[model samples]
Target: MAKVLYIKANPKQASNTFLISDSFIKAYKEKNPADQITTLDLYREGIDFLRERDLGDMGDPEKLEDRNHRVFKYAYQFLEGDKYVIAAPFWNLSFPAILKAYIDYICISSLTFKYTEEGPVGLLAGRKAIYITTRGGNYSSEKTRALDQGEPYLKTILGFLGITDFTVLSADCLDVIGVDKDEILRAAIREAENLAQKF
Candidate 1:
């Protein structure tokens, strides 16, 4: 069975972002019952920002190869995943700081990537990722897409790790005036269900 890592960046269960997550997870579990799924709620996880001790081996690639290192736990877990499902809300044109902090912990040398004569090469090739996000003001539009750094930043990071097969399921115009939030959420839920079948 493939390992599915589901990362939740939002805390509120009632939030539109988490509503999408709830739907996705439910459908994914039903469709891929044999798959091994691991859920990591970042807010409940209390993931800390990288501290000095966490980066003690930042300069040493050899040290990173030691999977037993306390700081390497995140990297190792990330590497073990065959697929990833990340759920977050668009905040201030980006995602939550906790999610960014989690990213820093996973992007370690000798685990997710390594430097070569040419440049750094990602090790986790062929892995796939699905980004699920909700935006209050319709960041998906061309007029405002550039303003949304949350999804793009996450995609770039995952791509850098050689996980190029990516999909995005977003719920937009959540808080915008006159927008039908319920209709948007229903459509997103339907999309999530459809995507889970092939995921």
Candidate 2:
């Protein structure tokens, strides 16, 4: 059975992003009934930030399971999967701070990625990832290109971890006037279902 980790970054309890993610999860489960799915909420769940003590014991075998050991273990759990799906809204042209913080924990040396002579190679391989996002403005135009920092940064970070295959689906102009939010959301859910069929 395949294992999927769904990361939710929206802080609001009933935000649009959460709704979109839940719809995706539902569609995914309906298609792959035998798959295992895990949900991680970056804001409400709160990821442990690396402190000075956590960084001090990088390669020390004696302190493997010390105070900050759980962080690494949790990160391993985050990376130890066949696929990942991330849902977040466009915040200041990027993701929430907590999402980035959680990523920092998982991207540690000798854990999620490793340095090599050629370059830093990703430790996790053959895993696919999907990103779902909603934006407040119409970012599809070239004039609004600056509003798309979330996708590129996520692609870079996940690619660095060896999770190469990626798919991104986004709904833009949610907050724009004279636009039908319901239709856009319905379209996104339809796309999610299509992706799940092929996932």
Candidate 3:
């Protein structure tokens, strides 16, 4: 059975993004009962930013530290998964710092990708990713797309890792004044459910 790795970046218990992701996972599980699912909650299982020592260990595999081992483990888990799902809320035009740290740990050279004679090429193939994000403001419009670093940045990074196939489910204008927050969230949840069936 194919493995699905679900990465949770939203720490808040009541976060709309988390709720949407949960709905998707539930539907996915129901549709694909034989599939294996794994979750990595960034807040619960903390990830640190790469430091000098971490970089040094990455350069020389022989001189591995405890933290480096954990980082490598994360990288290995990422490679093992056939599909991925990232659930995060847009924060300050981007995602949370913990999610960034998690990304840093997984984007290992020679593991996720490698530099070739022409340029950097992704190593992992035949994998796909689904990104679920909730934005406080409406950032999906042409006028505001440039300001949306969260979704665009994720797409770029995952593509760098050879995961070119992606499905983005975004719930925007969540915190906009006078907006029907409940209705927007319900619609997003329904969309998530529909996508899960074919994901």
Candidate 2 lDDT, 24-129, residue by residue in tens: 8999999899999998877767776778876876566566444347557656787668899999888999878788888877887767788999989998888999
Instruction: For each candidate in the order shown, give its overall lDDT on alpha carbons.
Output: 0.88, 0.83, 0.89
**After superposition, candidate 2 runs with Cα above 4 Å error:** 62-68
Task: Supply the TM-score for candidate 1.
Answer: 0.94
lDDT string for model 3 (55-78, tens) is: 877886553333347657788889
Cα misplacement distance, residue 182 of candidate 2 (Å): 0.9
Q: In order, how many clashes per candidate?
A: 0, 0, 0
Ranking by TM-score: 3, 1, 2
TM-score of each: 0.94, 0.92, 0.95
So what's the TM-score on candidate 3? 0.95
Cα deviation at 52, candidate 3, in Å, is: 1.4
**Model 3 lowest lDDT segment of ten:** 61-70
Candidate 2 lowest-lDDT run of ten: 59-68
Q: By TM-score, is 1 or 3 better?
A: 3
Rank by lDDT, descending? Answer: 3, 1, 2
